[model samples]
Target chain A: MRVSELVQRSGASLATIKYYLREGLLMPGEATSATQASYGEEHLRRLALIRALTDVVGLSVQKAAEVIQLIEGPGDDLFLTLGAAIGALPPYVESSNEQAQDYPLARTALERLGQVYDPDYPAVGQLDRALTAASAAGFPVDDDRLELYGAHVRAIAEYDIDHVPEGPAQGAIEYAVLGTALYEPVIAALRRLSHQDLAMRRFVPDSATDPAGS
Target chain B: MRVSELVQRSGASLATIKYYLREGLLMPGEATSATQASYGEEHLRRLALIRALTDVVGLSVQKAAEVIQLIEGPGDDLFLTLGAAIGALPPYVESSNEQAQDYPLARTALERLGQVYDPDYPAVGQLDRALTAASAAGFPVDDDRLELYGAHVRAIAEYDIDHVPEGPAQGAIEYAVLGTALYEPVIAALRRLSHQDLAMRRFVPDSATDPAGS
Candidate 1:
């Protein structure tokens, strides 16, 4: 397949395909001539993954490159590969240099979380960054709230892992990465829907009976 | 206080404060002269909220303005205000126009969710968009997965609404908005940490018993 065919099949612009090639996110096709290169099924697959990461998962090019590297690198250890993929995600909450004072509160929250999970896990830093940002914004999350949120999330994680298909290492790793990346928004959107449901229950419980009047 | 003092008090850059002012996100100060004006405590508060929305909640400047308008507009209807705040959030999952074919599957999942919640809710649209994007990326979420994710999220939302403080309408609305915004990343981070824990348990159960080596 040519680059144009890659574009047609992947629904990515020609320039985007070229950009991924330049950035080493997409491997170059086999050279057929000075001006032409032939792509293969592997190229199409890689391009799809790249689009999924960048477009759907919303990773930066640099972070997407890290994911690509993990996919292409040596060991087939599922644990290590999954770890690297999770680590490559850019933090959803960023800590600010000006708000160093908020770190102590965030650290306290992280310490409580560490008691239940790995203290040095990459998610710890990500959680700390989120707590720090929230605290700096004057919306500090206390220990109880953190624990409550953690408990529910742990349940979700159990379901997530329980469903991973028994298969090859690469398949498991791909499932972990793509599942985590893509399903995040699903969870978030569900949360929002739940919020509306709860809000209605709280604010307009009688409206259920009234039907048309209020 | 002057613009400089507003900057000092809000911890926002003078340029940023001015930009917010120019963009109508922040109201203009009272004019004392042709070139000079004085801001008040209201300005300071609004600036803080704007910063929290943009910096912590990651809302765009446009979305933040919608939040500001909701806060400043007439009526203390907590339900309406909270709804507006949630509605103003830009969709976390965006589907491309080219991927219209994927929407039907997403809409089907959303229809099942609608059986339990409001089908017309903005969050339904958000969830649909996310599902569509994932399906287009070849990561279609099954009905079982959607149900599993929704159940956990419903539990989280129960905790969220239960914890809303007893206060005036405006205060409760503020708490709801800020809590929802700030805790999103916390929930996401916890999910990731749980994933790591579950992965280790599933993939390396022997590591726990062996301690030293396998």
Candidate 2:
């Protein structure tokens, strides 16, 4: 297949494909002639992954490049690769002077979580950043709420892991990273759906009985 | 207090405060003089909310403005106000010509979810977008998985709504909106933390038993 077919198949624009090639986000196609190059299945897969990361996951070009490197890099360590992919996600809150005061509270919350999970894990840092953002916004999450949320998520995580097909470590790594990135919005949407349902049931009993009731 | 005091108290930059004021995301303070205006605690609170929506929830200026309108606009209806706030969140995936083929799959998935919650809700659109992205990325989520994820989130939602402070409808609306936006990252972080812990326990038995073992 040529670049044109690659573009058609991957649903990425010709310019985007070229940009990815220049950015080394996509591997160069085979040199078939002076003016023509041939893309293969690998290129198609890579292009799709790139589109998914940028278009859906909202990773920056640099972060998506890093993720591609982790996916294609010479490492069989599934856990490490998964960690890199998770790290590539945009932070919930950027570091700022305003957030400085909330770090202690964030750290304390993480310490409570540490009892169940390894506090040194990179995800712990992500958690801390989130907590700091919440506290900075004057909605400080208390220790009890954090624990309750953690326990609930642990159940979901167990189900997620259990569903991973037992196979090569590489397959597991791909599943972990892709599932984490792609299904995040799915999880969040479910949370919102649940929130809406619960809210209606508890607060708007009339509306719950007749959703059309304004 | 003046604008300077609002900035200092809210920890938002003076320029950002001015911009929000100009954008109508923040209400103008009292007209102290031709060139000076006095702000109050409400200004400070609104600034913090704007920062949290933009910085943490990642809403665009336009979306954040809509949220502010919903918050400040005349609305005694808590459910309606909360719905507007959730509706203001960035879409899980933007509509694209490339994604046209995935809509059926996304809709089917949402239909399955409708069995548990209102399928016509705005969050349902978000879930559809997410599902479309996942399917387009060649990782379509299954109905069983959606159900499993939804069950867990419903449990979490029960706790969340149960904990809502007893107060006036306006106060509950504020708590619902702010909590929804600010604590989203907290929920996501908890999910990641659980993923990391569960993965380590299931994959690296040695590390699971010996915490120091890498």
The sequence of per-residue lDDT tens digits that candidate 2 reaches over residues B1-214 is: 9877777788889898888888999899999899999988778767767776776677788998987787666287666677767778856434355545344554565456553445445676677777777776667887778778877777878887887878666666766777877777777777776787677777676655654212
Tens digits of lDDT, candidate 1, B59-80: 7799888877776662667666
Give the Å error, residue A23, model 1: 1.9
Docking class of 1: acceptable
Segments of candidate 1 deviating more than 4 angstroms: A30-48, A74-88, A92-103, A113-121, A165-168, A201-214, B1-11, B27-48, B74-84, B87-103, B113-120, B165-168, B200-214
**Clashes by residue pair, model 1:** none
| Per-residue lDDT over A27-103 for candidate 2, one digit per residue giving the tens place of the 0 to 100 score | 99999999899999888778777777876677788898988787667287776787778778856434455545344
List model 1 lDDT by residue over A1-214, tens digit each: 8888888988789988888888898889999999999998888777767766765556778888887787667275765676677777746434345455244544566456553444445565667767766765567787777888877888888988887878666666667777887788778778876777667766778634433211
Error of 2 at B137 (Å): 2.1
